[model samples]
Target chain A: MKCEQISELLPDYLQGSLSPDQRRTVETHLEQCADCSEEVAIWQKLSLLPVEQPGPASRARFEAVLQAYQAGRSNQPAHNSQWRKRFSSWNVFHWLRSPLGAAAWSAALLAIGIFAGLRLAGPKPPSPDLAAMQSELANMKQLVVLSMLQQQSASARLEGVTWSTRDQQLDPRVLSALLHTLRYDPSVDVRLAALDALSRHSAQPQVRSSVVSALQEQQSPLVQVALIDQLVEWHDRDARPHLEKLRQSPNLNPAVRQRADRAISKLN
Target chain B: MTLAPDEDLMLQVRDGAGEMLGVLFDRYQTPLFNFYSKLTGDRTLSEDLVQEVFLRILKYRQSYRPGTPFRAWIYQIARNARVDHFRKFPRQTALEPEMLPPVVPSDSAQEQQEVELLRRALRMLPEDKREILLLCRFQELKYEEIAALLGCELNTVRTRIHRALQELRKSFHQLTKGTAS
Candidate 1:
């Protein structure tokens, strides 16, 4: 059997998942090729690395979450401000208490509200300018609401704005909110929006720094490309080394490379 | 009136239950975090993703079914989050299969070195293959469970796992040859 074919079956053979004939073929190759034999030995040893369990930080985070729950329940008086607050307070407390309970309540409420809202709000569409105004007003209100929500229940507040539209341009306050969301928002959608917004205004140093920070720490190659694209636009000579590092990254998606190459070309 | 265990909690949080959700987070955070860490190769991003996954769970808590294994449901959420993350930031370079790090020469001093090398090499593998190996070897998930989690056919899972291991083996061979030279 060719080395490549035998090589393909090595994992299955090791796992005893291969057919008897295939296994024999691979075994024959292994005996003949010291290189393949050594490869097998290394895999066997590499597999022995201890599978790490969740560290203390994870448990601590969970404990803190439980504390937050207890605090929310014992401090129920905090929810008296508005109808939204009242609903959120109750929802937070219930969610803290039981998953099944929360599901049932959410399912019922969503069924009523989402269905009713879709039905009622569907037909009477407002003018685009009015809609934009309304959305902007809501976003402005959400800024305060999101801040309060963050203090009270950061996770929930973040969730509420995960899919929120970007209407604030690069206003400092709005930028701050987007930055906070990029760093702490629980929704990838929100994070992506923050990235997108920052990319749009990549000329600012603060925006550039945040995007670069996210890029350095980001694992998602897609997000990395977004940051790279922005950096490319900025034409920051300081960014060339970082771009080079990305060029050498084996996991970098090819599409990202084409863009990176173009960016590097621009830098040069 | 004191809230009934389920009813009181349900009524109190009609919008959804904060405390009950904590239990769910406690149960699955580690596996999910580890999975994301492996997938993203960045600790900070993984942590962020984990928190985001929980946030999503909270946002959609009302949609959850009572008897479903919370792990499976959360995994589905995590998978969706990952897909969305990828969609937003598509990669520029073609991801090459990573080579394995050279093995430690059976000495005690070399053990730690070997382990570090192995970890780095593991990190280098294509994301899909690395994920499969991790699910099978580290998480010890059954093939069927993995197939369900990955949304692929059972045979596809088997093939991918086999291919990943083969690639790792090849990488290791290359590393050894390079070192010996």
Candidate 2:
């Protein structure tokens, strides 16, 4: 057999997966083919490379991160530091007791009543530019979602994620912001919500790739598992490697690994 | 007593058992260190990257699900961590051939020389070829797993490996023949 034919079987042969006859044929070819024989020899000898140990401080660093992670989790609510700063001086009880606050509360109630009255009113008379008005409303809502996604408060950001899901077609700007939130949001809850919102738009290639990339960057096991399930639901054969890579991480939660494995199998 | 599997320990880590990560750190730091060290030929950077990989695990423990192999999942992180680091701070220095070292000094002088020549040859291949070889040969990733990791077909992976090996053989032969002359 020509080397081309033998090359087809060589990788499997090297892996020791070949049948006896095929293996013998390859072995015979090897006796006459110095280059092929030498290739196998080189492969066998690669094990000669030494495995090196990391410096001792490696464990200490890991310990620090683990401790910090737990400590941070314990103090998580407090760490929405930006929002906390804004809310700090505005004590709820103090504000409620103040005359100025009482006046402000009355004004808020009056505004709510007015808004409700407008909402309850029947649809406006047909206008010359109803499409323009609808587009303006959509732009306003998307602007709200984009701003809320950046809010210092996790719940508001989560609500922003929830609001995003209501739109059948996400504005590109809103979609990118949701993708950003999915990847970098400090709160796992908000990130998961963003993932849930974006998962609805898998028909968009951007959504699929962002979710796959998030599989690498995402820290929440719940979100990770959900991402894996979404990929499987889409039958995204492209996501198999990302899932496989996810399973390969040494620091993985076993549950997420199992989910990635199952997703890979299902996709396969 | 049987040691708990890495995956189970990871599950523990995910569920607020922060100390469980220490066990994993102990288990993986060396293999990961060697992977980066060999691939990049920079021991200091490799050590830093290994530390970074574990830190990411702690941060992303919620990302770990139970159904996959823990080793593969961590490798996924390890690969990304390295890629991201290089992306942010691209390497200015090309890898040094001598960096692929401590070739075990055995009794056969000729064998040691051959090993030395082989390391240089391995280093000489293009970055991707060297990486694929490292992932399969050194890291022990199965072909299917490599195919997934590389985002290529299984046959493409096989052909690439064969071509990589072919290149290594040619280089080693040339290096060896040069030494003989």
Candidate 3:
């Protein structure tokens, strides 16, 4: 074997995963090459070194997190309020919690109802100004959704992603926000929700590329599977390289690996 | 009937049996801490990262698919937590001998010196090399799994591991020469 080939196989050789033929080739190379032999010895010695053991405090910290998680889980009221407090603006309860806010919101709704009734009564042909007003309203909603999506709270982020899907036309800003969430959101559900929101815009080349690149960055298996499924459904040949990469990874979820393999074959 | 695996247990956690995560926490806390401890060379920080990882797992449990492997999923979270910590504390060095607790004690005088040299060599290597080495040698992850977790090709991971070890050896030799001088 050439030195480059031998070097490539050295990790597997140490791992005892090399095929007999491959192992024999490496063994022969090492026998004749003094440099390679010394290198192999170094790897062997390094492998035998002991791992640093974590102290009891590590377990103590884990249990504390576990207790907090369990506590949050068991107390149903806190869970609802916790989500509400973080995303109150996205929910009606936030406005209703204060009578003044509720009264102002009610007045605004009544005014909008009166305006809509007047527009319907006029029965005029669609005007450019009204269209502009409607588009402006959509932009405002998209802005709210994008801002909500950027919130640190996962539930609030989820609310933002869900809201984004309701828009008939996605603003470029909304699309970018969704892509960011898909790539970097701390919560898997938020990422998945971002995927759902982005799936609607997948026909756009920019959205397609963003979603494809996210496949490489996403570690959550559920999100990975969802990305694979969307790519396959979209027949996005651009996803071929990313799918192949995932296919070659040994630690991938078996089901995800299978899906990736199938996606690669289909895309090919 | 065969018992459910970690993935199933995680799915249960995903499905609202939040208490089930305790089992996983007990199972992975040490391995996870050891991974961070080796990677960062800081026991206290490693513990904090471990805690952060579990908390993320709980917070994101709803997104855990039933059939996906839990180990890969959890490690992915751990990797993210570590990466975030590194980004947040960019000024911190990865592996400092003073911060790193000693490994298992060596008996013979020469053996102790060799072990110390090896440890110093490991800590001196760049973060990426040290990380790959730790994953392969200490974490016991197969190259393929590491590849998957890292979102890279298996050959890429294997080559990286080979190169990492070579760099480590060079560092070890340099340290030994400096000591001899």
Choose the strongest candidate by TM-score. Answer: 2
> Residue A75 in model 3: shift from native, Å?
2.2
Query: What is the alpha-carbon lDDT for the whole of candidate 3?
Result: 0.74
lDDT of 3 by residue, B1-181 (tens): 9756899899777766777887888778878887887666678778767776876787677668877778878888999988875654464344465565544444547667677788788888888888888888777777877899989999899888888877888888886776666
CAPRI tier for the interface of model 2: acceptable
Model 3 spans > 4 angstroms off: A77-131, A134-136, A139-268, B1-4, B92-108
Q: Per-residue alpha-carbon lDDT of model 2 for A148-218, expressed as tens digits?
A: 67666675676678878889999999999998998998876577678878878888999999989999987
DockQ, 0 to 1 scale, candidate 2: 0.38
Per-candidate local distance difference test: 0.60, 0.77, 0.74
Runs in model 2 deviating more than 4 A are A77-268, B96-108
- Measured against the true structure, the TM-scores of the candidates, in listed sequence, are 0.45, 0.62, 0.60
lDDT of 3 by residue, A204-234 (tens): 8888888888888776665676788788778
* Candidate closer to the true structure by TM-score (higher is better), 2 or 3: 2
Name the better of 1 and 2 by TM-score: 2
